[model samples]
Target: MTTVAILDYGMGNLRSVAKAIEHVAPGHEVFVTSDPARVAAAERVVFPGQGAMPDCMRELDARGLRPAVMQAAASKPFLGICIGQQMLFDHSAEGDVPGLGILRGEVVRFPDAAMQGADGLRLKVPHMGWNEVWQRQPHPMWDGIPDGERFYFVHSYFVAPADDDIVAAQTDYGLRFTSAVARANIFAAQFHPEKSAAAGLRLLANFIRWQP
Candidate 1:
């Protein structure tokens, strides 16, 4: 069986993500882990988190999971969620933090002054609730998931890759933003598939089945 490790660096609802992956990937062995060796040894790795960018990076360094995460991102079919996605980039405007630099990008916050939606209502900072995602490129992760399907989001910051070629999907709130990015064996999303109900589960299922 393929072993899936959900990197736990003491951030976000790790169990919820673990449970969601478990629910969809019954045939695979899924475990929530912080051990670097376990993360490196897994067939696939998932990095999921929600919290302040600086705190997440600090905790990851404290736990010494950095190298393993870097290794997995380079050598395996890797998935990043929420702040997990942000951590892969070179930097984040949140707390002016530096990320793992796995991909060429930066995380930026939604402009406070430009928070007006199409209805002319001021949008919230966290960008919580469901929003439609426009798939920018074809990917195995998008299999069975219709383009423009709504997914759950809860973040003030979003990734802006220096190279637009890596962008896999986009979403609009106060502005159009990169919601998902794909490069080689890695696919990271700013939305929470676990909290996304059916479509989320389907995406998880696709990840489990994806060869990348």
Candidate 2:
């Protein structure tokens, strides 16, 4: 009976995320909404994004969903996915775009050139495919999820939180980066749990069962 609103900002894979959530929590109501009012009325909010950070921010601002999102995150359960997670930060180096500034930090590109191997082959940007997430702290949102589980990720930027204590999980591309973060009622993941198969479903289930 939990009412979950998946914010449709015109830049994310909204259907897939909603479908996945429905699969995980069958009877829960899932609504894909661009309206700030509906988003505010939901029991939980799921923010999902896949495109550039700046574009997503502009669209959210254009639609007047920014304040609603922040308000929902203030006391309700907020789950951010992929770019949605990055947007929670202060800024992103991707497009010189300012983010929601919810979390105090910047999203930076992978240190690809700086992490060259002995053969001088630089690590590629836009890390795509399945990557393992290392849990840093116990969270109700991560309950029943195991360590070393691979999740789907496709992004060039990663979150670097100013407060290390808020980091709930870490993942390595060229180096270790904050893959998941949790602060009070806000929880976010850099990877796409929708595309991560069973392990991903467990995460969605946990989010559904989580009490704030």
Candidate 3:
């Protein structure tokens, strides 16, 4: 039986994620765990985080999950969501805190000017609600999903990976931001699949059945 561990770093909705995964993949053992050893032992890891970057970074280290999370990303099928996705990068504008550096990129806040639409309408800083995520490249996570699907998003900052090839999907608020990233056994998103209805569920389902 496949074991999926949702990293419990004292952040985000871990239970909701576990339930979502359960709905899609019934046979898998899905559980929320803060234990680093359990994380390392799991067949798959889902890193879901919320709150500020600095606090999240501190908690991850405090819980002794930094190394295990990085190792999992490198060795097995890994999925990162929302703040979880941002922390995979090198740095974040939020408190100017550094990230795991697993991926070569930086997290930056949406510039105030970039918040203005072409019609002079201003969008909110935290880009909440559903927005269309445009596919930047072909990816396994996007297998059954369409090119432009609406997903739930609630974030002020976004990742800017040094390599554009790592970006799997892009979304436009006032500007285009890297919304989803994928490379090998890793796939991450800036939206909440648990709150995203069918499209979100599809991605989770795909991840559950993903071999790498």
Task: Give lDDT per model, in order.
Answer: 0.94, 0.90, 0.93
lDDT of 2 at 35: 94
- The clash count for each model shown is 0, 0, 0
Q: How would the candidate models be sorted by lDDT, starting from the highest?
A: 1, 3, 2
Q: Point to the candidate with the largest TM-score.
A: 1
lDDT of 2: 0.90
lDDT string, candidate 2, 65-120, tens digits:
99998998897999999999999999899899999888999999886577653467
| Residue range 1-212, candidate 3, lDDT tens digits | 78999999999888789889999998789989999999999999999999999999999999899999989999999999999999999999999999999999999998766478677898878888999999998887887999999999999999999999999999989989999999999999999988999999999999988997
Between candidates 1 and 2, name the one with more favorable lDDT: 1
- Looking at model 1, residue 18 earns an lDDT score of 89
Tell me each candidate's RMSD, in Å, in order: 0.7, 1.7, 1.1
TM-score of each candidate structure, all chains considered together: 0.98, 0.95, 0.97
How much does candidate 2 score in TM-score? 0.95
Best-to-worst order by TM-score is 1, 3, 2
Off by over 4 Å in 1: none
Which residue pairs show collisions in model 1?
A: none
Candidate 3 pairs with clashing backbones: none
Model 1: per-residue Cα lDDT over 1-212, one tens digit each: 88999999999788899899999988889999999999988999999998999999999999999999999999999999999999999999999989999999899999877589899999988899999999999999999999999999999999999999999999999789999999999999999999999999999989998896
